[model samples]
Target: MPTDQIDIERYHQLALQKQKEHRLFLATLKRKAPKNLDKIVQEVHTEVFSEIDCTKCANCCRTLGPLFTEADITRIAKHFRMKLPVFEEAFLKTDEDGDKIFQSMPCPFLGEDNLCSIYDVRPKACREFPHTDRKKIYQINNLTLKNTLFCPAAYLFVEKLRERV
Candidate 1:
């Protein structure tokens, strides 16, 4: 299916309803997931991403900005020619976990076309959004489950993965 034509809100609702089932399914995979699952998932991810242009659906950047690591902070600050403290004061804030995140949603770095203004130096978390191809997929099963709601590709990936496993 073409991701641009996907009904995001409908999928979000469906994903919410399937959360428990998905979790249990992931747990089952924790023990039984193929040793080559990462390679398989990578292939799926490539195919899915080819069909889905992220620039058309920046839901992840629009809804949940990435958590910034210290390195991300330094790189971004330098990109803007600002000091870390200055950058933080202007655009970042601490989350409940004390991790640095954007001060606002629809991230400040996100352009009108859903492209990242700082794409080259984006946070590691942003680079790895909807981490479907991460090795030892079980390690990030919970995160992947959460991603399914906002990311059409993730939702489809999980559905496809179910069939594969």
Candidate 2:
């Protein structure tokens, strides 16, 4: 769907309205996930992404900060020719789980065009945003549920998954 066609407010309302049902569905799937769950998720992910252009939305970047691993810090620091400590001090903060995350929302690297200025060196978590195609998807039911609030693609993936499996 085109950027203009994505109604984020409507998505949020639907996701919230269906949150309890989605949670129950995810719990059931976790207990008896299909043997081909990964394949099914991958197929749905492909179909959803083909239709939703992320650059047009960028809601994940705008509303959520990606967890930055040590390797992610090293790579990004090197990309900026800065020391890891300096980079961390400037852009990161430790979350309650002690994971490093960007200090602000609408990520500093997010350009006015809704593109990532550091796309080539974005964090591992950023690279895997939404993570709809990951293996053993039932393992991250909670994460997927949260993502439905932030990503139209993630929301659509779940909607389609419900229809398929």
Candidate 3:
């Protein structure tokens, strides 16, 4: 879908309105999801993402901070030719969960064109963002619910999965 076709404000409002319903649905799904649930979700994820250009809707990069593992920190720091401590001091902060995350919204690596400057070396969490296509779809229902608020592709994946299963 075109970026213009995606009304992000409308999605946010709709997601809020349906939050309870979606939560209950996910809880129920977690308890009794279909055996093919992962396959179905993967199909939906592929279909939704194929149509939606993420570069046009970098809301994830703009609004969400991905957790950076030690390996991720090391790799990214190496990419910048900076020491780990310097990189951490410059761009990272410890979140409530003790996970290291970017210090601010709109990730520093995000370019003006809405692409990741370090796409190849981006953190594992970032690389697995929205995570709609992961195996055992029911295991990450909570994450998926949160993602719907930020990722149009994730929202569409859930909607499509509802229709499918």
TM-scores for candidates 1 onward, in order? 0.92, 0.94, 0.93
Ranking of all predicted structures according to TM-score, beginning with the best and ending with the worst: 2, 3, 1
Instruction: Encode model 1's per-residue lDDT on 23-50: one tens digit a residue.
Output: 9988988978887888888888887888
For TM-score, candidate 1 versus 2, the one ahead is 2
Which structure among the candidates has the greatest TM-score? 2
Candidate 1 lDDT trough over 10 residues, lowest sum: 1-10
TM-score of the candidate numbered 3?
0.93
Candidate maximizing lDDT: 2
State in Å the error of residue 107, model 1.
0.1
TM-score for candidate 1, please give it.
Answer: 0.92
Candidate 3: pairs in clash: 1-51
- Compared with the true structure, all predictions reach lDDT values of 0.87, 0.90, 0.87
Give me the runs in candidate 3 sitting further than 4 Å from their true place. 1-5
lDDT of 2 by residue, 1-165 (tens): 554656777888889988998898889889999988889999999999999989878888889889898999999999999999999999999999999998888799999888999999999898998999999988999999999988888889889999888
- Model 1 whole-model lDDT (C-alpha atoms): 0.87
lDDT (Cα, 0-100) at 146 in candidate 3 = 89
Determine the C-alpha RMSD for candidate 3 after optimal superposition of all C-alphas: 2.0
Clash totals for all candidate models: 0, 1, 1
Clashing pairs for predicted structure model 2, backbone only = 1-51
